[model samples]
Target: MNDIWLTTGETATLLGVSRQHVVDLCDRGELVCTKAGTHRRIRRSEVQRLFNPQLTREQEKSLWLHRALMGHLMLDPQKVLQMATENITRWKPKHRADGIAMRSLEQWEQVLSGGVDVVVDVLTGLDEVSSDLRQNSPFAGVLSDVERRQALRSFREHWDHEHTAA
Candidate 1:
């Protein structure tokens, strides 16, 4: 029986992962998927397919691209584009320099609602964070805790390279 698949966002939410994680898993042959307008659709049957664990051409490409991007970021820190994801400001403000200024949408409702260029820190629950702001933010998106942990390592690698090179 052919079962209808769920959307990437839905699967990502249900799986407690980022949309990018969902995409990556699908690309890596861990999850069989179909793409529709930048989103992915995962079938229930495909979940079982993941148990087989065989690499496909698509998976190879995905893996290669992943390695290439990581290598590029490591080798060429000068070309990397950085963006701010979250900003938390305490009651006492500190000297700021580089990027966007962010504060709680709760305490700093004015700053958040001012339509500034940076992401606003709105008071939100974890579930709300997965649903609402994740969809809207161009600069940030939700990732599975595992993915976040890995991404953090990847980021650290890049940052460390930049520091050493400088």
Candidate 2:
């Protein structure tokens, strides 16, 4: 239990997938693994990487912006949600012919309609769906210009510190 390696079933539990799926991922070269005698062993880090794949600099920055919005959302859920609704209403017409953007916008509408818990989940999600939704985020203008600048500055400073420390 104190070992750094995990069994396939353990990895599956962490990834919210079946053990066979973890095996398939290892076989497909999606997740790295090694054999311990006849059993497969994966590093804890490998499982973490699969569950939370790394983000690009731009994606990290976007996450920071949303985090700023999330702060406001917590303080005033109705007002934050209203701004998102308005943004969706405005962007929907312009993106009517754009399949990807339209899908993201539609998903945003559902998330917003589902209320604050749903919104918070999607806002901080690091999954592919959340990443795609963020590409066409409807939370624009939820934060003031000064807030946006502050969030971005904070992100940059943190990013710099992390990289330098590493």
Candidate 3:
């Protein structure tokens, strides 16, 4: 009893196809339609179903992680770098501790800045960093290993399942 419906022309327009193509899809049962007098009517839900397939659990998690990481990077990358550098310096003090921490920070910044081709590598590195920080840094209680592992797992699963052209 979903009152929402779309005419064949509307369906075609939404799909970016010709009316004939929409009709063909209907004929092939790829898109379900019902006859309404002289014209065909497609349910709004049916059109949505055809256009937007359901994502798997891993895919959903990957999408969420990707968005969250990208949002954090875009919003305040400096803050992220500062926290990471502090953690690195505290965890491992050496002759060039600041330089070493800065190098890692620079690499993370480069990845966020689109210099790196593989996103999974960046995510994996972040996961490793988070794990190290959780174990050794004063911020250990603030960071969650479970969350980092989940994001890393999602990224790894997504990378394994999809063949990247890059």
Please name the candidate that would achieve the greatest TM-score relative to the true structure. Answer: 2
Q: Which stretches of candidate 1 lie above 4 Å from their native place?
A: 1-3, 48-166
lDDT, ranked from best to worst: 2, 3, 1
What tens digits encode model 1's per-residue C-alpha lDDT throughout 31-82? 7888778767898666545444444333433333333344333454333213
For all candidates in order, the CA lDDT equals 0.45, 0.87, 0.58
Residue by residue across 101-149, what tens digits does model 2's lDDT show? 8888888999999999999988888976786778788888888899889
* Inter-residue clash pairs, candidate 1: 18-144, 105-121
The alpha-carbon RMSD values of the candidates against the true structure, listed in the order shown, are: 16.4, 3.7, 14.8
**Model 2 alpha-carbon miss at residue 124, Å:** 0.9
Lowest lDDT 10-residue stretch of candidate 2: 157-166
The clash number for model 2 is 0
Quote the positional error of residue 154 for candidate 1 in Å: 44
Q: Which portions of model 2 miss their true places by more than 4 Å?
A: 1-7, 15-44
Candidate 3 regions off by >4 Å? 1-3, 58-152, 155-166
List pairs with backbone clashes in candidate 3.
none
- Writing each residue's lDDT as its tens digit, candidate 3 over 1-166 gives 3458888888999989999999998988878999988788899899888656555554445444544455454565565545555654564554354665545544544444453233334443324343332222222222357766776776776776774565
Error of 1 at 40 (Å): 1.7
Candidate 1 lDDT for residue 67: 39
